[model samples]
Target: MAAVSKYLTAKNSAAAGGILLVLYFLKQRRRSAALNRKKGSANDLNSEKDGKKERAAVDKLFFVRISRIIGIMVPRLLCKETWYLFLIAVMLVTRTYCDVWMIQNGTMIESAIIGRSTKGFKKYLFNFITAMPVIALVNNFLKLGLNELKLCFRVRLTKHLYDEYLNLKKIITGHYVDHLHNFIFFRFSMGMVDSIIAKYFATVVGYLVVSRPFLDLSHPRHLSSSHAELLEDYYQSGRMLLRMSQALGRIVLAGREMTRLSGFTARITELMRVLKELNSGKYERTMVSHSEKDVSEKLTLVPGSGRIINVDHIIKFDHTPLATPNGDVLIRDMCFEVKSGTNVLVCGPNGCGKSSLFRVLGELWPLFGGSLTKPERGKLFYVPQRPYMTLGSLRDQVIYPDTHEDQKKKGISDQVLKEYLDNVQLGHILEREGSWDVVQDWMDVLSGGEKQRMAMARLFYHKPQFAILDECTSAVSVDVEDYIYSHCRKVGITLFTVSHRKSLWKHHEFYLHMDGRGNYEFKPITTETVEFGS
Candidate 1:
């Protein structure tokens, strides 16, 4: 949890830091903009205004920076004991220098046995050098291996960042998922690993360079107790001291930077809490009432078997409920029934409450005046007029709601999937790399008409009985639309369609209509002797 706190705090610091960076960049841009405007006009007045804004932006940036340090980086330092060991290993392995130290030293013979004279030691030293590097490498490499143990330390911040990334990729909806994934997966993990490896390797090289001076000698025969050698030793010792000082300074700075990051994390968390208040306070609510008073509440009584999804009594746009001002709900009395194997068409006109009705039914919005009954959350599939596609293999697109193993269990093979794609005219596109679950800027690749067809392919793959398609096939050609619908019909799928293409109306046997007066009348357009093109 401390690691999570650390991660959050770090993220917070980054966010705060970003705010600073943005403000600085904006200030610079504005200054330039003002200068440009001033260059032709009166400079004094505009300059004063630009100066004021720049100063304000600078002040905010400074405060945000300070907040990042306190909120993010400080907490990391507080809990860094867990991670210090690995970093220390990185330091130790990087600084090892026995080989470099031995490179220039006096006669190889003396080194083999400490008391032997410098020239006599040469033979043994030659033998030792060949075998010693192996032991030295192993010993030093083992110390570096200690780096693996560091992963065991588990920084709270790193884990939290990962969790946030995971939850985002797995559960959260809307735009931020892709953006956050890019940052956490690429920037934090791979980027940090690269930077760290480079610095440590540089330190290792430095050790090799620094150790070279120790081997330089004056008059090799008189290895000890000689004035010339002593002076030379003194010069080399001074150089070593200077190099060590420089290395020490660098270590201090690295430590300080880590501290800064830690502190920045703390300040970031402090500020971030304001943003994360929504997430950290997740409270699972138990449905309180077994029975609902109004149709709205009644909708809740069914206990949706597919997903324990939340349904609200009011749908608000900005703070106002999207309803008729007369307390006549744009969606007055409504019950949403989505059973598996049902296809629902959500239809209405330019503000006749069709999209609003689907929005309410799909659980995206609240029923302004009714309660909703739903199955398990995430079970019901909603295909909008313009469906969203991700960048992935073509396989991913066809197998969306990817969690449901039943499709595979039912022996829905590649052949079956391809047949479905061909029905929707997407079979040709499948051969394109990554077309299976292609997450391209597909919004661009496929024309508006093709996108709707692709949505149908997604719908067919999931085969969720209960689907609310709100003009989902709007842009498709009438024939393609007929093919998709006819396929659904052959599959005996229950459907609720909302479309103005009167050609599509006969596809649904049951219909619910909402009047502009904010009251919905659910009547049986239902005919049991179901006939298509009726």
Candidate 2:
């Protein structure tokens, strides 16, 4: 009777532990789900209509996205990742078997003590001691395999993303910016949820198992062989039940991990889809205007488009409408022509299509009306208001967009580059920064005026037939700017200058003026024109 009562007590304790574990896991899952819904609601409210549509698509095809991502990460059946996964599965099975053996051996140890059999106790204890190393080895090996698998997934996925993103055939600047924003936001939001759930589970599990009570052996009750055997069976069965509950809890946690993976899969799949569309020359953007008519039209490509022709030695735009990427038409009809050595000055109000015209000429924005004729790609160059500093040595600052080999192919040595720098009065930077090989964060290291001068040097190094100077020398002194202009004319390079400075009027042969109302005049630059314009 005592043995039966003790067996019942042990059985009840194990059942209670299992129940508590399950209840805790359930509570955590509910809490996580509630938090997710709250966050998702806030995101939906702040997101744009396009974002909402994308989210809907992602949710609707969650499983399909997961499969696509899995295909990318593990491309082949005979890959190393597959072998790692197989080994991990084997280790898991081995660990489960070891756990079962340890549980049974523990119950036997307890029985031996209860029956006062020293030989049985010593034998079972030896078995437990012998199995501990094997269990530890299996556990560690499983962890190593999992880490390796994760690394392989990351490497493969990153490589695939790079291939799509950096493909030269269909690169879109605005699309990349949008995709980056989505990637960051989704990862952060989903990663937070996973982190919170994992930490909560770990804390609860630690506290629950911190002071587990062993079998009550203070008062041993001897029993018949049958009762002892039956008691051992009961104890082992209870322990196995507790282990099963723990395993189920782990499975639930893994499901949470899968939820996070689904988020990642959605983001990656969306990126791939967008890239494919861009490669095919199809693009979509939210219309800035909220007109019902505009929404109804819903043009996939930029509306009212035109044609582009590549020619040599001249650039002409015949009735091209300057439009922004957001479908805001800046100018209805723009017509201008410039040949080699013809310098033109552009002046206008703040939003009056001064830069927009240049963007069309450069093919940065789509030509959205009449025909455009420009010199082949290498004959034209652009210098923006703010210059971009490449990541390389001082020599790279001058010979930008060209490698040392390219410079060598042109038979222009570093000494020639130095002369180009001197034309812009930046020759002393080599001695100041120690040598041509010295590299630093040039953007932060150089002042605004120095950066502008370096950009001019880069222009001189390239020496294209036509250069669009969009207020690029805003930070330079009038004297240095004049010298730069004289050097450009000396080199026979045509200029389309975008500036409102009175000092820049003398260098250009013609002036193109734009009013904010889309009216424009292209006329010769004279004393009357400059004074009247001022």
Q: What are the lDDT scores of the predictions, listed in order?
A: 0.52, 0.75
lDDT of 1 by residue, 165-233 (tens): 333210156568888878688557634643443355434434444334334343243356555444444
What are the clashing pairs of model 2?
none
lDDT of 2 by residue, 1-534 (tens): 334334445456547556765775677668666766876876788677435533322244888787888999989999999999999999999988888788989999988987789999999999888988888999999999999999999999899877765442312999999999999997797567545544554444433332122232433332333667656755775676556545645654576566677677777888888666644556655334232335464323343247878887788889876667666656666788888878999888888888878766766556555788888667889998899999999988888989888989999988888898888888888768877878899999899999989998999888898999988989999999999999999998899998868888889998888887758888887667743333
Q: Ten-residue segment with the worst summed lDDT in candidate 1? A: 298-307
Query: What's model 1's TM-score?
Result: 0.42
Candidate 1: regions farther than 4 A off: 1-371, 383-394, 401-407, 430-455, 468-478, 489-534
Judged by lDDT, which candidate is best?
Answer: 2
TM-score for each model: 0.42, 0.63
Best TM-score among the predictions, by candidate number: 2
